[model samples]
Target: MRITNVAFAPGHAAFYFDDQAAIKAGAKQDGFMYRGQPDTLGFEAVRQGGEAVTILLQLENGLWAQGDCAAVQYSGAAGRDPLFTAEKFIPLLEQSLKPVLMGLDVATFRPNAMRFDQLDIAGAPLHTAVRYGVSQALLDASALASRRQKYEVICDEWGLPVNAHPLELFGQSGDDRYNAVDKMIMRGVAALPHGLINNIPQKLGRTGGKLSEYVTWLAQRIITQRSDVDYEPKLHIDVYGTIGNIFDNDVVKMADYLCDLEKRATPFELYIEGPGDAGSKDGQITLLGNLCVALKAKGSRVKIVADEWCNTLTDVVDFVDARCCDMVQIKTPDLGSIHNTVDAVLYCKKNGVEAYQGGTCNETDISARACLHAAFAARPDRVLVKPGMGFDEGMTIVANEMSRIMTTLKAKEAAHVDQPLQTV
Candidate 1:
């Protein structure tokens, strides 16, 4: 099927006040409160008077593809909040995507190689968030045209589970940071009930007192909260180069903290995300090796997960080949297509490494549905699906469209599977 039309819908909305308050209160009880506005950190608070951007693509024969891009607010020291403001990336979508994608047969697009040359040409200066938005649209369109769930298309083609959670945490507060953590947990529980929640904690530097203490405290909280659940929530912490300066010593301390948490009868699994600037390739490998040794010595089951350092499937393959980590986190935009993202997951599987899908903070329902399809299809070890939760008339419409797509695809799949072969 061909892409018939591409549309951009950009707008704003208010956050869910009650949800934000519940999150803030939970965090305060755990000693984490807003360093900025009282309820600003929760979805309801930040969405108040802010814009939410959505992009939709329609295919030939009236099929639909859509997603959202929204900015989330956070409280932290200056330059450290992990909010994703979509303005920097929307222009790429607003520009003529039709020229780049129209008339091209969706069946012939090589999802894996499409981004390789582009990424190489762009080098490290790539606009990750923008690339992610554009790629998500393409995946949605491709899935709709192919008559497959985005996740199924991704998994069957790429070899990984499409249902992994991509947890994002920003800031460096001690137990006092519990509000953000609580909100994240609640949201994960609410939005992605069937998926894994990969917790990516912001880093603590060499002078780590409260930061380290907080990591330990939060680990305990997760363990305690999940004790009764059938499957303990999956967690991954992002050090973001904050631990690079101290390396082994910090890893050891982190391991100790994790061991203590596990000792509390909390069976949750934990993974460590590599630092962003440590030359993610070599740095992540070395760090994972060191972490593995330390965890082995302490008998901890914590695994190492590659994130920022693993921008491509090749990078992930290299890391796996080197025995650097246990899991490879697939950042879809960085890979540039649903197919390639699936390929990355498959590459990880080939090497016996678990794969998890990561989400861009600026994703909309169209993108989330694409992600959901990818997750469902691949059935990855974990996934993170985030759609800006706001009250927008357009947002509601986008969601309805997504549900329709899912229903249509499932019906078509069932029909094909049940059909008897025609006599030649």
Candidate 2:
């Protein structure tokens, strides 16, 4: 089916955008707002309300398919696209993208996604957020035209088998690390508490003592409150490079710390994301590659994940090829088109690197659901529970959607199995 029309609705994303540069530069938090001038060009303050634009595509079948255009929480850093506010992008979407979307056939997903993903306006490609949301709309339209689930559309086009089971879900705790983590354990999250250890003074501690203590507490909490003896969840923490900072990027020191942290985790796998930022892609690869080699040499079981400086599909490939990280987080929005997310995940799997299909808290329900469909089909190692920082809300959205889709697919499979053979 073809897209009959396209419409745009400016709206709020589930979380706020933060000026990463300013925050790293020690912006003080005053309540929810950061009390400092913005360091990022598009940001008016250190932190501001995040915005999203809903792309609604009217299908020829008289149904509407929608997706939310959203940027990462820490935009304008790490070679990513600038902050995405609905007001700044609505006119461009109308003038440049609406016409393209209006007459496109949505019978398939990849070509349409690539068309918009690579579309140039004023000598530059459309913003990542635009491509992200628009591609999602096209995917939904394709699935609708085929009268199949979104995951089915992905599997069919990409030659991947639909996962009979749900991908592992990783939950984030935002700033409410302690309370929210308790909620995650109770809910049986496969990955627990992405402790947002962005701050050195408050969260990570000057010498990294704070984080070590937190890890010990996390392991103890899980042991005490777990539903069963086998309820061991991976302890994945994103430090935003603070660990690298405290140790002065000393690979040996970092390896020792990680090895010790693994012991503290005690029987659970540990993944540390963004251990260090080297300010540029090559530097980042070198830093992380050395750290990975160091950890492996020491026989450390802790896995290092690449996040910063790994924004696009090319970046993910570069990190994997360089053997810089054990896992590469395919941050969905940063990759622009959802097609890239699929490719990155598959590439990581092929290269013997784990893929974390991660997106930001600054997304909407539409984008989060679209991501889940991709995750189910691509079979990433783990997928982030997202669109908000609240542990419970995101958990509910991700878990319930997974359950609904899994049940539907399983019932269909059972029916086909029980059907009698017929002669043509």
For lDDT, the strongest prediction is: 2
- Candidate 1 displacement at residue 155 in angstroms: 5.5
Top candidate, metric TM-score: 2
Lowest-scoring 10 consecutive residues by lDDT in candidate 1?
Answer: 190-199
Instruction: Measure candidate 2: CA RMSD.
Output: 2.5
lDDT of 1 by residue, 1-424 (tens): 7777767666542331122323323322222222233443424332234444555667786876655444322221112122334454456555534355555455423452265225532234224333445566666666678765555555445544333233222111222246544544543331112111112232253444434465566656654554345534555555544444444436676566546534442344555565323443676677666766777898787676776556666776787788767877776655544556666766776678888776444344555566556555554566653443321322343334445655665565568775422211
Q: In candidate 2, where is summed lDDT lowest over 10 consecutive residues?
A: 415-424
TM-scores for all candidates: the values are 0.62, 0.97
lDDT of each: 0.49, 0.91
Candidate 2 C-alpha lDDT tens digits along 1-424: 8889899999999999999988888899999899979998889989999999999999889999998899999999999999999888999999988988887889999988888888999899999999999999999999888888898888888887666776799999999999998899888989989999998998998988999999999999999988799988999999999999999999999999989899999988999999998999999999999998999999998999999999999999999999988899999999999999999999999999999999999998889999999998888999999979997778888888899888887777768854422211
- TM-score of candidate 2 versus the correct structure, residues matched by position: 0.97
Error of 1 at 133 (Å): 3.5
In candidate 1, which residue ranges exceed 4 Å CA deviation? 7-58, 62-64, 67-97, 107-131, 146-148, 155-231, 246-267, 275-280, 385-424
